[model samples]
Target: MTHFGSNTLHVSLVALPDAVISTLAGILDVMNGAALMGLGDAKAQPPFQIDIVGERAGPLPLASGVPIEVQKSIDDIESTDIVIVPSVLLASGGWQKGRYPRLVAWLQRMHARGAMLCSACSGVFLLAETGIFDGKDATVHFGYADAFTTLYPSVTVHPERVLVISGLREELVCSGASTTWHDMVLYLTARHAGATTAQAVARMFALQWHQDGLAPYIVFEGKSDHGDGEVLSAQQWLAQHFSVAKPVEEMIKRSKLAERTFKRRFTAATGIAPLEYTQRLRIEDAKRRLERTDASIDEISWRVGYEDPAFFRRLFKRTTGMAPGAYRKRFCIPEFARS
Candidate 1:
């Protein structure tokens, strides 16, 4: 395991210089806090180092009427393990040529040398502007997806998911909205700091340990302003436990409905059977584990509670139109190799 100082995953924040938004800074605050807490709790320093770097080393204004001084410049970003570009105003208008001149040059220098490029929220817009996210699997905040899609049609944008870590191409990742940033930091922490260290950090902050590939949006905990009591209860349970579907018998017990009546009621309530609903939940869970964990097909099958890998394979392949292995190749953000 590495400490923050030891791992030091330098993050370069590309501020739009007068972009008037501190979204990036805010994200940095949270990430740095998480890192410090994550690493400090493990009784170790995280192997990661985060730097809010940009075109220059100076004060940058935010939409909140505040300015944060930039401590690192483009030249200072050399050989960084991770370069993050936060959301800034497009008015800078430097990335139109996929070459914001200085930004482009910096990105080229680091990218060519195999550094990871990370984009947060609207920051993804700037990354796309660099032509680096092109043909890559990425994501933007839900609000900005439409504009991003309209602007960069060549890049494959995943709308349903909150964050995307592209197929193991030199550590490129694009994520925005929901708790995606939290997941990203945890991932980086685990990678640099190790799972044991990461767990220690999580325990320190009382943060729940997360499995990569589960989108933050799927955990909508607060009650919606609409829906009946039974509906809301079911929906809440579904949201919380969709990854590990409750047994139908358990659900029936909880609902206190007879089998025949429960079937009719559940179907009428959500237009889906209890069993079917649970199946969908398991499928989604299996799909997530498939994409994130380095575990083999059998390992993943078991992780999702499938006793028979063959049946899991059939169900997965049938639903996704590709074998589990092939699906991993097709949809996995960080493509695996036999190291």
Candidate 2:
């Protein structure tokens, strides 16, 4: 392990051709800002020394077609305190396995040397390629959850978390979604520097940390690619009629499968039982109504198929971790009634 001087820490931002340019630049800017803030203090020098390192030194074009000048190549760096892999624009065929063997090998070496690895969004794909995240929990962009799970089945994917720290030593840090670079940088700043410095940087950037998990923004679209014809038809029917009370019997009859068979197949395909699926669908609709309409919680709950207002409130809180009124208050349009 490379021992860092008491006053300074080295950081490497891995520059990839397919990386999102804004994320890379934004991380660098925030780190520099933190460093500057620390430097202003008489007793403390800046803790971070950041470098933009690429697979090969020189200019590397981002997915946006903008070229970022890299200060050093990965081969030139023998050791660093931290390594940050920025998100990449997924290609048409998806993240190609073994596409950057050299970079993967370098990352492996760095981790083996005890440097912490942090990834943002799809950058988790690269870290997964190193097998470092295998058997560990990690998060990535919600859009890529299915693909990431399909690719790395061993790693537990938390699609709803904005950030996750895994590994026995907690050396692997991951941030979900593309814009979560703000959250990741702030977290790193707080971990390495201090809360005061992190808060100052947050104030400077006007960046608010999203403490709520990503669940509120996620729409529970039923997965239908399970290749079960009867299940697919039932799913389609349920999607159209989730607001209907007592959908299980109707779904089973429409599927033409016996009750046991229908329930089993639906659970296997969707990872949730039929009634639970309907509840999720109804709650999803209720969330939409809460956000876009001035409707009261009881009215919205009944409209979404709940007959018991108290039951609906509990279910809403259980599913979303917030009361129905709180959800509306946070998400409802300002022009709509604020009740």
Candidate 3:
């Protein structure tokens, strides 16, 4: 809203007690570097103005227990071109509702005033609190997708995406996982500064975009915290014998509940259907085997219960975003095999 030049965007990083300092530092380095490169003069004033904005001005300690001096408070910043909420160390209890009322209000005001707002990983949780992401597509760490979905059901979560750009005018930007902060900053640099400046900064930082997405990194662990003893027992049994033929049907029999009841309870407890649960267990087994063994994809597929190697390959690619051979090549440990 207060833009001065094509390359000049006022960038503000929100500082919170539980914020990840490394993410903040990475964005600062990339943005500053891009600004310097765009100006083409080390001595000239950088085109971009970057600041650490906190709830209250002064020193704020991050989750790392290190203090960072904030240059401006949320109250002091009336308008800014861009606001970045860095990733935070989200506790198991999750983002407490109404805990950051002032910050949330300020974020809404900024969005309403035409300032672009961005978040990385769990920072999306904070940004969501502002209601700016309602009915919009966003992304966060895959591990936290369920929690985020539960907390903000209105915001569709694409856990597998490395980045999601949404909202009216696409002013709201989100990046998945903690490290994708690099992608978000680079995107901002390319948009406000120039693609050339962004490329130079990326080269300097050795930053790479995670094009493979979070699927390859997600480990399928069955959710068992629900208070259903039958579902828990079924999950445990499936874990040991997922490759068995008609495993979901066998699990239903073992659960001792009616077919519909068992299916309902399993889906409720695991957040997936019985058949999907079995597939995940089998895929997890295949992943481990691929990581530690030199077995052919056909053999591994058969070992994991799928008789049709072609079907297994397709499923593997669908669930993991990588073919079996690609997964093996990426994850296999040559040192372990040698040992």
Q: Which candidate leads the pack in TM-score?
A: 2
1-48 per-residue lDDT for model 2 (tens digits): 112125777899999988999999999998888655443464555758
Flag clash pairs in model 3: none
lDDT of each: 0.64, 0.87, 0.86
Candidate 3 lDDT by residue in tens digits, 1-339: 112243457889999988999988777777787544453454444557899998999999998998989999999999998999999988778767788889999999988898998998889999999887889999999888988999999999998898999977989999998798888887877776567666777887789877788898889888888988889988888888888999988988887789999898889888899988888889999999999888899999999999999999999999999998989888887775666
Instruction: Give the range of the ten consecutive residues with the poorest summed lDDT in model 3.
Output: 1-10
Pick by TM-score: 1 or 3, better one: 3
**lDDT of model 2, residue 90:** 92
lDDT: worst 10-residue window of model 2: 1-10
Off by over 4 Å in 2: 1-6, 37-43, 333-339
Q: What RMSD, rounded to one decimal, does every model reach?
A: 14.2, 3.6, 3.6
Q: Estimate each model's TM-score.
A: 0.54, 0.92, 0.88
